[model samples]
Target chain A: MESLLRVEDLNVRYKSYRGELKVLDDVSFEVKVREKVGLIGESGCGKTTLLKSILRILPPNSIIYKGKIFFKNIEIIKANKNEIFKIRRENIGMIFQDPMSALNPFFKVKDQLYDALRYSVHNIKSQQDLQQMIIKLLKEVALSDSERILESYPFELSGGMRQRVCIALALTRSNDLLLADEPTTNLDVTIQEQILNLLRELVNKRGLSIVLVSHALGMVKEFVDKIYVMYAGQIVETASTDKIFSEPLHPYTKLLLSAVPRLTGRWKAEGLIGRLPDYVNPPPGCRFYMRCQQSNSNCKIKPKLLKLNKDHSVACWLYGDEEH
Target chain B: MKSLIISNETIKFLLKRGGSIIFTLIGLSILIFILARILPGDPARMAAGWTAPDWVIEEMRRKLGLDQPLHIQYIRWLSDVLKGDLGFSIYTKRSVTVDVLQYLPKTLELIFVAELFSITGGILLGILAGAFPYRLPDNVVRVMSYIAISMPAFVWAIILQLMFARIIPLFPAGGQLSSHIVPPPRITGSIFIDSIISGRFDALIDCLWHTILPALSLSFGSMMQNARILRMGMTDIKGKDYMVLSDALGLPLRLKIYKYQFRPASIPAITAMGMSIGADLGNAFLVENVYNWPGFSRYGVTAMLNKDLNAIVAVVLVVGIVYAIANFIVDLIILSLDPRIRRMSRSV
Candidate 1:
């Protein structure tokens, strides 16, 4: 499978009043054509930051210290304004976590979608063409009553409906890649399921390559074909979703899976001990070393991501010899 | 747009606002009337001069209807006002309405131009400052706005006059027209409009030229206030989810600022600008005197000093009415700009 997107040894830092916080350190990731990739991590673990880095949309204070993000053959970090805009307009679509705020409140659904279409698609000029295209997009997102939905402001719609509209908006300009940053995180559990199902349907129907960033291991389990478990700004492990769930390898992944509440209700859910290390002056080794129960002298050196099999990779000293 | 303007909800909103404005104007009129009456100078005695006998003052008082009880006087004034009569101005020796019609439009023109300059300039500067926050542009805007906002309008008026009118000699020192130029025939009372309407382009140019110093002085403080408000709003909005989405979507910076970001950021600035209308008019008194532009505020000030009760009352009422109307328009604009407000209005 040819890679549609690739991140090479990406290092991102945020300069704050306190210090330069290393947000993403040596973070390498890849997505193949029509592939669904999931990035699982706790909050502030650079999940969203990684997604934004791919799109080159980091905040003003952020510095891409070392990295190369390639959407196809184009290096996003080196691309000019027009090139980046074209790529964002024609190739990439993003769905934010909060549907309530992702769409602009001041505009109606029709206007927002129309703005996207007008900017991204060149042939769309006449009002009639715009309206038809908007209706078609709305229908694609499973929103019936397209006319009423088009005229209504975002606040007038329910959370589910707003998410659907956001999906439609993202699809308006995007043809290939969908960067969904916890799109269902802010929704009700039922609505979350529906949005996930809709995203699945979109991937199947349109052959879209998606990078789903979420903290819910269970949610990502049923969504993506491959999962990359992230810990402290680096991908600690990557495997097929089933493989990762069945035989979790990374210490952090094992802790994360163990942390998920069980249906049996034996009261066995224990959270991972210790908070994330301070990124301003992070440890010069594996970030999870302090928290790892099996940490030894060798853990003082940062572990390289070693491929143990065709579909499994782990970045830990324990898996270092498994590659051979 | 038509639906938004003419909807039943909008009508209800307008009616409610109109009713409130009428009541507010009435209350304001009553307050000003009492304050004017209690002021040290007696209108009748002032009208008669200090050397006049007590009998002459009494006769003057009777003629001016000041001898009547307070309630009776208020009732009479209210009834006359309801009947479209503003009564006579002893200061101008004409009907109060005529004096207002002659003077008010000039002040309004100055205010209108000043407000236009301030609002447009403020929003642009605010966008500039906000886009490059904490950078050189932002720092420059911050310092300039601080300087503009710290000074009173009249001081700016004097300084502007000295700089532009005397030092540069680019604009006239004072007055509405050059002594040599023929005044445009007064159709709408505003010299600029009347000049344009009468095809006296020369007079129009001269009117704009004379207005520059006065308008600049009148605008700077409020303009800076608007800039500060819009700057703050834009900075605050920059962190909003929609703005992040806009950036991520790679919408052009211009479109993002003007279309996506501007409306939300401009709400507080618009509200501030509306309220500043009253302040601008009050400040215009000194500005008018400095320019000798023959505006309503100067007329009203002169009337107050001479205790011209009818003129003072009329001026205050006019100012109050204008302020209320300006705020009403601001509300309407905000209603259109924010759909959330529109939805609330519909629910109401």
Candidate 2:
């Protein structure tokens, strides 16, 4: 598989009224061809920030202090907003956490899809051409009532309907990479399943590389080829989904997986202890040192990601000593 | 029990707090009366002039009912108000309504012209600022709005009169019509409108020329506040994901800001016209005074100095009505624009 994106030594700092809060520090990852990479972690672990940095959509106050975000050999960090906007049309695409909010209230679904196609399809002369393109995209997203939905406002649609519209809009243009940030969090159980399945199918059928950002390891473990488990602002573990799920390396991953509610098991819900500490005045050394169940003397020392295998990595002192 | 809806719920909520309505009305009405009556010195005596005798002052007091019971006089005033008669103007000795109506057209005309700019032009500026978000133009507009808010209407009127009327001498300073020109036969009573209606092209031009200084002054503050509020509202809505969707879809930046952002942001400002319209009705004392425009501003100032209680009451009542109507329209617009209100309200 060829490398599609390479995020090297990425860092994001927010210059707030309070002080400079280092949100993302030295975070790096890569997505290979047709890869469904699941970024599983609690929010505020710099997952969403990493995604926004990819798109250059971070608010004005946020500063990218250090890093280079490379998209297909192009340095995204140096690109101006207009250049990024132009690039976003053909090279990348993103879906937000809340599907319902991902659409303009005043416009019809058809108009929204047409807007999405504006970056892809240039020189549209007639209304019928735009309509046909939108209808075709809607059909691809599996929305049967394309005509009616296109004419309706976003608020009028159901959650599943809106999510489908969002997905459809993203698919309107042939973008290289797809970034989904908790796309199914706002949906019902059945709808979440449907969206996840749809995303998996898109990745499988069309060879679309997706960066799936979510806390749900169980959901992504099924569809994603590789998994990156993040805590605080660093990736604690990176391994194939099968290896991560079957023989989880990091203590945090074990705890995170155990916390996932499951059926037909005597396993009781042992909630992860300790609160997310205030980002300002964060504890020195290892961020998870206070919360780690098996914290030893070496655990207090900040650890870099230690490569355990060609396909797996773990950022823990315990992993440093282990040969397996 | 009947089914509850948004409008019904809002009405019930408002009506339930019946005390607030009554209290507001009483407070306003009392303030109006006190403002009318207790200004500085003896008004009737002022009208009587410096050479008039003590006996004449006594006669004037009796005739005008200044010597009568204040409460009895207030009741009689309220009764006359109910009958739509504003009583006699102590200065002109004409019915206060007739005096107010004769001048209303002038003030309303200034308000009408200024309001056009405040509503249309001010909103357009706000939309431009909002569309760009953190752009340089947005920052410029933001700063300008603050400046607009800080400057008083009267000061602006004076400056305008000095620049355009006095020094530049491009336009006349005061009066609804040129004193040299024979006034067009009163068609709509408002000189500008009547002039336009009668196809008195010269009169129309003259009316506009005389109005410029005062209208510009009065509209300055309103335009700033409207733009600021509009910018704020637009900025907030811009943060919402729908805007991103619009951008993602590749909607024209112009269309997104003008059609989507401006309408939502301008709702409050649109409603604010009620207060400005009402304020315009009362007249800007400084603007009217500076331009020598014969609007309520001049009347109110003169009435205060002369202690013309009847004229003051007439002005206050008209001002209050204008204010109420402005707010009423704002409320209606708010209800229409926001669907959340429709769902949450117990009555529709």
Candidate 3:
């Protein structure tokens, strides 16, 4: 399958009062057409920043220090804000975590959707066309009583209803790629399951190249084709979902899998031992060295990514040692 | 059913949170009484003289109803106050209602002009400033607002009078109309309104021209406040996920500000706007007096200096009532605009 979106060796930084905080350091990932890829990480692991950087939505102060994000065949890193905005609205659709807050508070749903249509649609005829497009989009999202939902404000709708409205609006132009940032994490368990199922259906139906970011890896496990486990602003492991979940390579992935509670049986799983290492004054060699169980001179010497199997890769000395 | 719901909500609000303003009124009234009592000059002595005999003082005091116990006096004043009789001003020998009515229009005219610039102009400037936050317009507004907010209205009025009125010769330093212009029957209590009503374009022109300096003086500060508030609100709002969502959705600039930022952000700012307005009115002491404008703020300053109890009380109450009403109207607006606040008030 052809790669629909590719992020090559991306590094992002935030200039704060303290210092230049390295948020995303040398992170590379890809999404193929009709492929569902889940980029999983804890909070402050730069998942949202990474997604936003791809969308070119960071505020004026933030700096994408190095690397390029290619959408289709074009490099967006050198693109101006107006150029980026034009591409993002028409070709790339994004959904935020809090659906209710993520939709404009004051505007009616139809108005918001119409605005989206105006940006996405190259040629427009009349008000009737806009209205028709809005109604059709609302129906597409599986919202009941399209007209009613269209007229209502964000405050009027329930959480799940609002999320669907957002999704419906996002899917109005039927874009190629969707960047979902922990879309189901804020929702209740049942609602979370429904949203995940909906996303899975969307991937299957729309042929969207989705880069789903989440801390809750379990939610995206069944849906995503591939998984990238990130730790301390770098991808520690990348594999097919089955390979990664069944037999993870990285020590961090092992810890992550062990941390998740099982649904069926009693599993005495100890959570990851320590907190994330500070990014500003990060440890000299390996960022995750302090927390790793296997501490050695080789471990102190930072290990780069190595491919073990056809579909799996791990950035650990154990893999490097085993390979040699 | 909705009417009942509204009235029930109003009743609950009045019974609960409304008590605070009334409590404020009572507390402020007591402070007024004490301030009057503790004042070195006695009403009788000041009205008469030191040599006025004890019998004369006693009789004069009795006639003025100053012999009653403080609490009883306060009760009579408060209750009669509820009946809308604010008592007669001893110095002016005029009913407080009539006195207030006489001066109310002038104060309101000044307020109207001030509000014109402050509310509408401020909103425009604020929207502009917010749209281009940290940009040239944004930075200009930031500095200008700081200046306007920091400098009192009186300072602006004086400086504007000195600059535009004196040097340029476009507008008068003071008064609502030109001295040569004889206003017809003061039907509307506002020169501009009366001019429009009478089909006098020249009068309207003259009135508006004369009002320029004071209104500009008043509005610059207010505009600064409005701009600052809007900028803060816009900055805060831009931080939200929804703004980015709106960006991804590709909403227009004007629609974003008008629909999204203005109402939600403005509701909070308008609530606090009453104090600025009331202060503008009250602080018009120097502006009114300097301009030789016959607004009640001038009367209030004289009353304060002369220790005129009735005049002082009347002025205080008028200022209080203006503040109270402004705040009430703001709340009403907030309740309509944001159902969240209304629901919170009802639930609480």
User: TM-score of every model?
Assistant: 0.93, 0.83, 0.90
A best-first ranking of the candidates according to their TM-score comes to 1, 3, 2
Between candidates 1 and 2, the one scoring higher on TM-score is 1
Clashes per candidate (backbone, < 3 Å): 0, 14, 0
Alpha-carbon error at B114 in model 2, in Å? 2.3
Best-performing candidate as measured by lDDT: 1
Question: For model 3, what is the alpha-carbon lDDT of residue A137?
Answer: 66
lDDT-better candidate, 1 vs 2: 1
The CAPRI class of candidate 2 is: acceptable
Please compute and give the TM-score of the first chain of candidate 2 against the native first chain. Answer: 0.94
Q: Could you arrange the candidates by lDDT from highest to lowest? A: 1, 3, 2
DockQ of each: 0.68, 0.33, 0.55
Residue B274 displacement (Å), model 1:
1.5
Which parts of model 3 are misplaced by more than 4 Å?
Answer: A122-132, A145-148, A295-302, A320-324, B1-38, B49-56, B71-85, B342-348
Question: How well is each residue in B177-242 modelled by candidate 1, as lDDT tens digits?
Answer: 988889999799999889999999999888888888899899999998989899999888888999
- Please provide, for model 3 over B146-182, each residue's C-alpha lDDT reduced to its tens digit, 9 standing for 90 to 100: 8888998889888989888899877887887787887
Off by over 4 Å in 2: A106-111, A122-125, A146-148, A276-285, A296-302, A320-324, B1-85, B128-148, B247-252, B280-283, B300-310, B328-348
In model 1, the runs with Cα more than 4 Å from the true position are A121-128, A265-268, A318-324, B2-5, B88-94, B196-199, B346-348
Candidate 2, B1-348: lDDT as tens digits: 111244666675556445454566557777788666666688668767767899998887788777877778788777887798888877777888888878877777888888876777667777778767779978888888778777777778778888888898888878777877778888667887777787888988888877766777788778776777777778888877877655554455676777566655666667665566666555477777777777766776676666678888777767766676566566656655644443354332
